[model samples]
Target: MTDGDARLTDICSGAAGGKMATIAEYYAGKNVLITGATGFMGKVLVEKLLRSCPEVKALYLLVRPKAGQSMQQRVSDMMTCKLFDRVREDNPDFHQKIIPISSELVQPGLAISPEDVEKLSGCINIVFHCAATIRFDEPLKHALQLNVIATQQLLSLAKQMHHLEAFIHISTAYANCNRKYIDEVIYPPPVEPKKLIDSLEWMDDGIVRDITPRLIGDRPNTYTYTKALAEFVVQQEQDKLNIGIIRPSIVGASWQEPFPGWIDNFNGPSGVFIAAGKGILRTMRANNDAVADLIPVDVVINLTLAAGWYTAVHRPKSALVYNCTTGGINPFHWGEIEHHVMSSFKRNPLEQAFRRPNANITSNYLINQYWILVSHKFPALIYDLFLRLSGQKPQMMRIFNRLHKAISLLEYFSSQDWEWNSENLSMLMSQLTPEDRKVGRPTKHAARLGQIFNILQLTYEPDC
Candidate 1:
C-alpha cells in the first residue's frame, strides 16, 4: 500500500492495563497551539493544561479580532473570566504562558501573517482544533465555511508544523445523527466534499439556502452535516499525522474539576433549566425514556488532553476516535435531567418568577401542544397584555416565539435516543495515568451530574 493508504501498526506493547506516562509529564515543555481558545471548551482546556501540566512551555492561541477588540485584548479579557478563577488562584502568573496569534478561521490561510505562520510552523508540537460554528440554524454556506473548509485549512497548516506530533480535532457526538447508532469511527461523508465545495463555490447564498434541505438529507441541520464532513476531511491525513477525534454528547456543566455547576452561556440544556427556573417554561416535548447523554465540560477536556498525550506518545497507527459520552457508562435520561432541574430550582427558586417553578416533559405531540398552548402561549399572551396595560413594552409574546423556535430545534435530539458506542472512551481511560483516571470517572459524578445539565429555555445566545 502507498503511504496515504497505510493502516495502523497497532503498537499494542502497553495498549491496555499498564501504567503509562502521566498526562502532565508528557506535556512538559511542549509548545501547543490551540484554536478557539476564547470559547467555552477552549478556555477550560487552557486552564487545565496550565494548572494540571504546569511545566508546559507555552500555549499559542489562534484568535480573531472581534466586537471592536483586538485579539490580544480578547485573550486578555478571557483570562479575567470567572471560569479561569481557579487557575488564577493556583498560579497568579498563568497568563504568561498564553501567546495570542492573530488569525481568522474563515479567511484564507486563516488570516495569519507570514511571521506568525513561521513562528507556529517552526515550534508548535501539538494542535487542538476547537473552533467551529455550533449554531444549529446556521446556513449551509456559513456552516460549511467554518466547520468543513476551515478544518481542511487547519489540517494543511498542521502539515507545515515541523515538530507537530499530534492533532486533536473536537467533534460532536450528534454529527452523525442521521445514524441511530454511532461508532468510534469516521463514517463516509454524505457527499464528496470536493464536489459539494466546487458546486457551491459559484452559487450565491440564496441558491445554497434553497438546496440545503435536499443536500443535508437525513441530518437535522447544517452544523451536523458539515461536522461529519469535517471528520472525513481530517481522516484523509491520518496516515501522515498523529490524530485524535473527540465526539462528546450534549456537553453540560463541569461535574467536578474546576468546580461544580460552572456554566457561562445559556446554550443547550442550560437555557431550558434557567427558563424553567424562572417559571416561564412549563412544558417541553421529550421522550421520558431517551438517554440524555450529557457529558461534562471538564470530563470532555480531560479526555481531550489525555487523547493528545496518547496520540503523541503511542503514535496511533491511524486516527483514534474517542466517543466521549455518558451513554454507555452512566446513561442518564432526559426525564432525569428534567426532574432534577425542576427540583433544584423549586427548592431554591428563582427570584421574581412569572409563576411558580413547575415544568414537565412528555413524548406525545398532541399532549405537548396542549400544554404549550395552556402553559406557554396563554400565559405569555396574558403577561404581554398586562405589560401593554401598564404602559411597558409588550415582550412576552415575542420571547415565547423565540423560545418555541429554539426548543423545536432541541426536541429532535431529546425526543429520540441514539446508541453511541463508547468502547473507545473506556479503552483510552484504561491507558491514562492513575491520578487522571480517578477524577474522570463517569459513574463517580453521576449523582450530581444528573442535575447540572442547565439547558436555558429563554436565554438568547448567539451560539444557540
Candidate 2:
C-alpha cells in the first residue's frame, strides 16, 4: 500500500482501541444550531448528527411557516421522513432534542423573536449555515436576498452567541466558475455586494434584468455570482469567529452511508439523469473529457461535520476553505456518467418512457442544436399530436420547452472544465479517527449489489 493508505490504516487501527476522542465524543453535550434544516443536504446533515452524535444536548433549527403549515408541523414532518429512518430506528424519541425557531431569512432581524435570539445566544455551540436558493433561474434581487443578505444576517447573529465555537457555511464549488483554476481561497467578487444591493434595491425588475448580463459578465447565472459574493461576505467575520467554508461540486446520490443510490433532488445532474432515464432528454452539450466532479452528499456532510469540529477545537486564525470534490483524486467524466446512467436505465427501464434510454452528448453547439431539433423537437411534436387525437391535453411539447430552457442554462458548466485545489480536504481527512474514516466502506459490497437491482429509481426533489 502507498504511504497515505498506510497512515490511514494505522489511524483506523488506533481508533479501534479507543486511542482518542472520536467525532461523536467531541460533539457530546453540545448544542448545535442549523439553518436550512428543511433542505436536501440539510436533512442529511441532521440525520447523520442525530444518529452519530446521539449524546448531543439539543438541535436548534431555523424554520419558517409556509403553505399553512406551522413551523412545528414542518419540523415534525421532517423527522418522520424516510431520510430519517435510521435515526428513528436508533432512537424513537430523537424529536425531543429538536427545537424549531420560527424565522424568515429575508425579513429584518431574520424575523427571529428577541426571546429566541437570547435563547440561541446562550447555549448554541456550533452553527451550520446551509440555507440558500439553489435555483439557476431565480431573479437577481431574490437570489441576493437569500444567498448574500441572509448570510450576512446570520453572521451578525453568530457574533452574539456567547458559547459559539465554529461557523460552517455551505457553498458551491462553481461559485467562481469564471476562472479556470480555483484555489482553496475566496476570490474577489465581480462587484461589491453592498454596492450592488444598494443600487438594485430601488430599481424596477425590468431594468435590473436588462443590466444583469453586463453585471454578471462571464458567470452564467445569478446563483453562482451571489454565492461568490456570499463567500466574500462570510470572510469578513473571520477575525471574530472560527469559520470554515465547504464548497461541494454537483452533489450526487449517497455513496455508501445511509444507502447507495439514495438521491432526493433533481438539481444539477440529478435532473439530467432522470430526464435521460425517462427518455425525455436526448441531447445536451458537454465536453466528454470534462471531469464531472460529482461529490456524494453523505461524504460532504462527513467532511462538513469534521470541519466544524476542527475549526472549533483548533480555532484557526483565518477561515479554512474545503473544496469538497472528486475530480482531482478519483476523477470521473461526463461521458462515463452518461454511459453508466443510460446502461442502467435500459436494463431497468423507467415506468413509462417516451423512447428508449438513449442519450447523445456533444461539445459542438451546432451539433447539439441539430440533434435538439431532429431528436427532441420532432419526437415531442409527434407525441403531442397523438395526445391531442386521444382527447388528452397536449403537454409533451410544453415539457420539452421547459427541459430545453433548463438544459440551456446548464450547458455553460458542462462544456468547460475547472481545476480545484483540495489540500484542505485531505488535511481534514487526516484528522478523522480511523473509525470515522472507515464508516461507509464495509457496507459497499452489499450496497453496490442493491444499487444495481434498484438502478435509477430516483426520489422526487421538490422544485424550488
| 418-438 per-residue lDDT for model 1 (tens digits) | 998878777876775443454
TM-scores for all candidates: the values are 0.93, 0.93
The 0-to-1 C-alpha lDDT of every candidate, in the order given, reads 0.83, 0.83
156 Cα displacement, candidate 1 (Å): 0.6
345-450 per-residue lDDT for model 2 (tens digits): 8888887888887898999989999999999999899999999999999998999999998898888888888899988977776676555555322234433333
**Can you give the lDDT of residue 197 in candidate 1?**
93
